[model samples]
Target: MATVLLAVLVAGGVGCALVVCLLWRFHRALDRTPPDVGAFAHSAATRTAGAAAARTSSARMTNLTSALPWAVPLGTSVADSCRTEDRNPFLGPASWAPINCVRSTVFYLAFDGDIRTHLRQLDAVLAEQEWVGSGSSLNTLTGMATWLSQAGGDPSPAASQQGSTEPPGSRPICLSTTYGPATQKRAVPHGGLGLRLQVAVAELPCTPSAETGDLQTDGRPEKSPVEGTVYLTWHPLSTDTVSRSAYTAHRYVAALSLVDGYAVQSTSTTAPPSPLTR
Candidate 1:
């Protein structure tokens, strides 16, 4: 009877030990497996990841549009003082200002002739501020030269230095917004385009807006993605060339689109300089 009792006791102890060992092994396997992918990230980490993704997507739009000629990044990268929301003293509710502006490359898709004749003609109709080339005063580009930016209220110092004076064929002549106001400014918003013409004295007639169909004469897309529309008729041009027809008159109209984008951002208080300021 004593031996049987002792044997029962021993069996009970062994069973308990086995159960404890199995439980520990089960816990070890669970720890070895990867954690739930979602729960592992903290809230701050998740937020940062989301913001980075959003920025990446937005940056793509800027990149795709960069293919357009005379394209520039929209920021106060110039002078460092020129801010995105620089206040304009002349017009505004709060005297709001624009910190940055973007202008397209002034290219004449099909000029009447080579750069010289075209510059002379364009200048005649254009105000002294209106030019036909590029200037490095703003930001230099490859192949073509650079030009100064236009601030409607007060022209910057760099603006005076730029004009049609640059080596004509070397780059497009300089043009400014002080020209025939909205209509002319929109035509050559940045400057003039750099012509790669081997043929001088070529004739490409202008039609109603862009209707004359010079841009379409070749493989070029009728409407430009940058300038859009064929003509810069103050607004959008209906055709590709200026109208020489008696009914349309012989006025030389600049054909282009709005180089200045959006309604234009009004000036607001800055978000404060970075803490690690120089």
Candidate 2:
């Protein structure tokens, strides 16, 4: 009887150790995964809208929109629409004042030219807006350049810097979102596409409000998993560029979307920055 009891205790101890090991590995994986900032901020905004939400005034919206635009190339037609909302989950009651502002603007500009030429134009716009570049900035210029080269163009100047030299044209573009491993390749019209263009111009470095998390856009909302950012999505001219009418008809080539306003945290109390912000 004593021998059986001893054997049971030994087995139980081994089983407990194995269980602990499994739990440790599970926690380690969670640490490796990046936090979903937009989701967290959105949740916070929804929870705090009544008592601690920041508000955007009309004058602030005017000032913000005025400051947002970079010079559009002449002859590239421009159309834009703006909106302000109280309950729009995007216009938040989050910790960051700029994102919490109650308005968003979208600009659609169509350039009647080659995708390469327009890409350069977009590069200039990004530069003027102080968006980062590939080696340091992680924007579309380098990624697209790399993609173009993979699609039979000359090797991209930025290709040497990539960790993987193989073509990423057909790979999923957004790194922030979760998607099931895809079997089918994405269709490419004009050869293939590289990485999606993304750049952010942050405004109002003011004190954070009672809330502790500020969510910024990881890229454009439509193409990227990130939100609360100024995103630029560029569409290449159609393959049938030989027809002038068709080219002209493609009026919406590239789009820029952003949540607009200069709302900042207004609380007098200073709290330690949220760990998420770090």
- Report, for every candidate in turn, its global Cα lDDT versus the true structure: 0.27, 0.29
lDDT of 2 at 169: 35
Q: 28-84, model 2: which lDDT tens digit per residue?
A: 544232223233334433224311211321232234334434323212111111111
Instruction: Give the Cα error of residue 240 in candidate 1, in Å.
Output: 5.3
Q: How well is each residue in 1-278 modelled by candidate 1, as lDDT tens digits?
A: 99999999999999999988887666554423221222212234323433342343234223323332222222210000011221322222222233222222212232222334443433343223233333332221111112321222222222222242323223223332221232222332221211110101111232312211123444232333221121221122222332233213221223322122211122242221111000
Clashing pairs in 2: 132-137, 133-137
Q: For model 1, what is the C-alpha lDDT against the true structure?
A: 0.27
Q: Give the per-residue Cα lDDT of candidate 2 at 240.
A: 18
Q: Estimate each model's TM-score.
A: 0.19, 0.28
Error of 1 at 214 (Å): 18
